[model samples]
Target: MTEKIAVLGAGSWGSILANLLDENGNDVRLWSNSEAQAAELNDHHTNQHYVPDFHYSESLTAYTDLAAALDGVAAVLFVVPTKAIRSVAQQVAAVLQQTHQKPIIIHASKGLELETHKRLSQVLAEEIPADLRQAIVVLSGPSHAEEVAKRDITLITAASEDTKAATFVQQLFMNDYFRIYTNNDVIGVELGAALKNIIALGAGALHGLGYGDDAKAALMTRGLAEISRLGVALGAQPLTFIGLSGVGDLIVTATSVHSRNWRAGNELGSGQDLKTVIETMGMVIEGIPSTKAAYELAQQQSIEMPITEAIYDVLYNNADIKQVIPQLMRREGKPELQ
Candidate 1:
């Protein structure tokens, strides 16, 4: 069956996923807010600014009109940044209401709403009414856009309360080089996906400061503890922290050179100001905002996330990274499982 799918966002991850869907024999409409981007994709089948030296599937089309891109689609994938999710969802809600089309809503964005500290799934569900959408799903894991574009063996999780909806997504994207696993623990999956970026920022900062491997390993291990701790406090499954969305995502994001969060952290650790690094990155480094959201959430939940707090101090309070390191080290340690 050739399903018509609308992938909303024309950035690197969005373009890659849209092309993959088109390659999987779907009628894909990639929505970009920029007219130039739409024209670039439509005319030359390339999104060079975001994914350089890559060609998109010829059949994949790009659209500037929201209604046209969403017309008669079976599924809508929100691939925009975390901050843009709600606004885009609002636009989609209006369009769906006008067309009377109900499609499964899936999002690849991994971050919390800064103001509300809600998961991206929760943000989508809030703006798009239940009547206008079949189900809300989160597709996340360790996969990166550059690797997926190369057709590297990539595995991810499709999570939703609706098993059939998740299965629908699993079947939609799985191929020779791509694999999808379905998980019911949406809270854990989303938390792990969002919080790992914070840890990645810390890892990058460690590398920037010329810290050795032992320090990097300790930060990641203790960072996972903090992620699992806060996640479980918010009613997530404890075991889910050990799954692909949890430890798997943490490892890749914290260690990979392709990670924007890590790169941003590296710049910060190397003594570049946050504003300058963000202005120069040319892409959204999700960890900066995620650190703020997670830090505030931790305070509200009364959860102790020391590594998150340390990173937060450096990013927000203008604390010195060298000084922050020793402070984190001086904290009285407890049992590993605690």
Candidate 2:
């Protein structure tokens, strides 16, 4: 069936996903906040800043107005950053309220809200009226926009409490190259998606500090443990941590060159200031803000996440990564599962 899909946020992930859908013969409307960008996408068929070296599907359209984008769309995919979620969602809620239409809400962004520490799904559920969205789907895994744009094989998870909703999303995007797995564990899936960036940041720092592959391996393994611990405390299945969204995501984020969080950490470890790095990257390095939320949440829940705390100190307290990492290594050792 031909589906009308609205992809909000014309960033790398958004543009790529929209392009994939268009390639699959779906009528895709991609919405970028800037009117100029929308015009560029519509006319030139290229969003060079986000998804460079790739041509967008010419049939895919771009829109600046939320109402126009939502008109007659069966589903809306939010590919914006975490900080922008609430604002964009508010606009979506108002439009849905005015139009009296319900659309399946799917979010690909991964990051916890800074202050509230709410998962992206929780944030959406809080902002949009329940009547507007029958269910919210979270799409996440080890996939990168650049790699996915190249049609690299990607296996991601679409998680929702509603199995039917998840299955709908799974069927929407699965293609020859992209595979979707439906999971009912929304909390664990979202947490694994959001929290892995912190470990990626730490892993990048280790690489920048001239550490070997052994350090990277250690960080990924221990990071998964902390992520599992905090995720389990927040009502996620412990087994979910061993699955694709958990260890799978951690490995890719912590090791991949395409990761923004890893790049940001690399710059910071190479002695650049966070402000400078953020300005230079010109991308949302989600781990920076997510680290703060995870740190605060860990403290609130009385969960001990040593690697997260070390990364938090380096990023937030201006602690020297070289010194702080050693302290992290010298911490009291216990059973791996404890």
Candidate 3:
């Protein structure tokens, strides 16, 4: 049974997912915001800007129009950068009015918005109609698009309050090289997905500072602890942090060369300004704004997240990263878990 799938955003992740769906025998439509990119995918069967070295299938049509892509689709996967979630959702909502049967919407992005400070799912809920919001699901993990696109072994979790919605997405993406796990902890899944990028920046900074495995390990462990604390405060199950979305994602993003956040932090740690780092990266570095939102979430929830605060200060307040490191080390000693 082939499902009709529409994936918005023609970035690496979206193209990878589109390829995955096509391999799984689904009718995949990949929508690019830019008509030129869409035409490139349609005519050349390649997305050179993002997923280079891979050709899309004839089954996967690239459309610049949202309604044309959504037409007769059973599922919609949003894979744009986190910052573009709202704008894309609003456009989808306007076009989806004619279709009474709303497809299950899945978001594969991994950051919270800065101005709205909303999660991807929250953005979907607000922009998509209430009826359609019921089908919102988050597909996340440490799986990098480049690896997944190359058909490497990858594991991800699809979470939704509605079990059926999650299951639908799981069926749409799961294959031999890509494994899918279904979970009901949407908050924990999304929070872990978004926050790991922030921690990855910290890890990159540590590595850039010439710190050995011990410092990286400490940062990773403590980072997960703070993320779990904030997750618990925000009504997510504490144990969720121990699962794939939590420690799993943290390990991958923090260590992997594919992580933009880690790479950006590496540049910053090596004494580059934020502007310089962004210019060098040439892609959406999610950790910058996510760090700010995580800091605000920590303060709002009255949870202690010192590492996140330090990262926030370094990114937003222009605090000196080298100076902050020593300040963190000099903090009054306490029990390890206290």
Candidate 4:
């Protein structure tokens, strides 16, 4: 059976997933808020703003009309930034009200919104109509959209309270180059995806400060501990943090050059100001705000997250990044895994 999928947000991640769906024999309609971007994809079969070298699939259609994209769609795939989830979900809900059937939503955004401090899935659940929340699923992993679009081997996970929804999404995206796994721990999956970027920024900062393998290893370990503490505080299963969504994502984001957060940290460590670095990258760097949010979350939950706090101070308070190194080392520490 051919499924009709509406992919919202015409960014690299959205385009890659839309291509994956097209390869899986689904009818994909890609919707971009920017009409110009939609037209470019519709006419040129390329998202030149993100991935230009790859060819777009003929089975995919691009549209600026939200209603047209949602019409008769079996599933909705959201690939926008975490900040845009609420407004987009509200639009989707309004459109679905005029439609005959509600589509199952599968999204791949990472990062919690700063204002409400809500996770993407939580925002969707709060904003989308009650009936649609049950069918929501989140897909996340160490996937760099550019690599995935190039047919690189990328493994990801689909998580939802509804196992059926997870399985359906897994089947929708699995391909020769893209592998999908199903899990029911939405909390763990989303947190793991969002929190790693913050830690990656810390890792990059350490690297920029001329730290070696020993320091990097310590930061990664402590970063994972901070991630686990926040996850535990937020009702995530303990073991999930050790799995793909947690350790897997942390390793990739903290180490990969493709990570925007890592790159930002590298620039910061190399002594570039935040404003200058952001202007140079010219793309969304998700780690900066996420670091602040995670720091707030730790404080609220009474969870001890030293790495997140340290990064938050360095990022916001203009705390000396180089000075924080010895400060962390001097802290009276207890057992490794307390």
Local distance difference test, each candidate = 0.94, 0.92, 0.88, 0.86
lDDT of 3 by residue, 113-217 (tens): 888677889989889987754588999987898888778898889999999888888877787899899999999999999999999999999888788899999
Give candidate 3 misplaced runs (Cα > 4 Å).
Answer: none
Per-residue lDDT tens digits for candidate 4, residues 1-93, read 479989998888888888888888998999998888888787878888788677898768898899998888889989988888899999998
Model 2 lDDT per residue over 1-338, tens place: 57999999999999999999899889998999898999989999999998877888889999998899999888899999999999999999999999998989999999999989999999999989899977999999889999999899999999999999999999999999999999999999999999999999998888888899988998899899999999999999998888889998888899888999999888888888888999999989999999999999999999999999999998889888889987987888788779
For model 1, how many clashes? Answer: 0
Candidate 1 lDDT by residue in tens digits, 174-281: 999999999999999999999999999999999999998998899999999999999999989988888889999999999988999989899888989999999999
Clash list (residue pairs), candidate 1:
none
Model 4 worst lDDT run, 10 consecutive residues? 125-134
lDDT of 3: 0.88
Question: How good is model 4 by TM-score?
Answer: 0.97
Cα RMSD (angstroms) for every candidate in the order listed = 0.8, 0.8, 1.3, 1.3
CA displacement after TM-score superposition, residue 220 of candidate 4 (Å): 1.3
Q: Tell me how far the alpha carbon of residue 52 in candidate 4 is from the true structure, in angstroms, after superposition.
A: 3.7
Residue 233 shift from truth in candidate 2, angstroms: 0.5
TM-score, each model? 0.99, 0.99, 0.97, 0.97
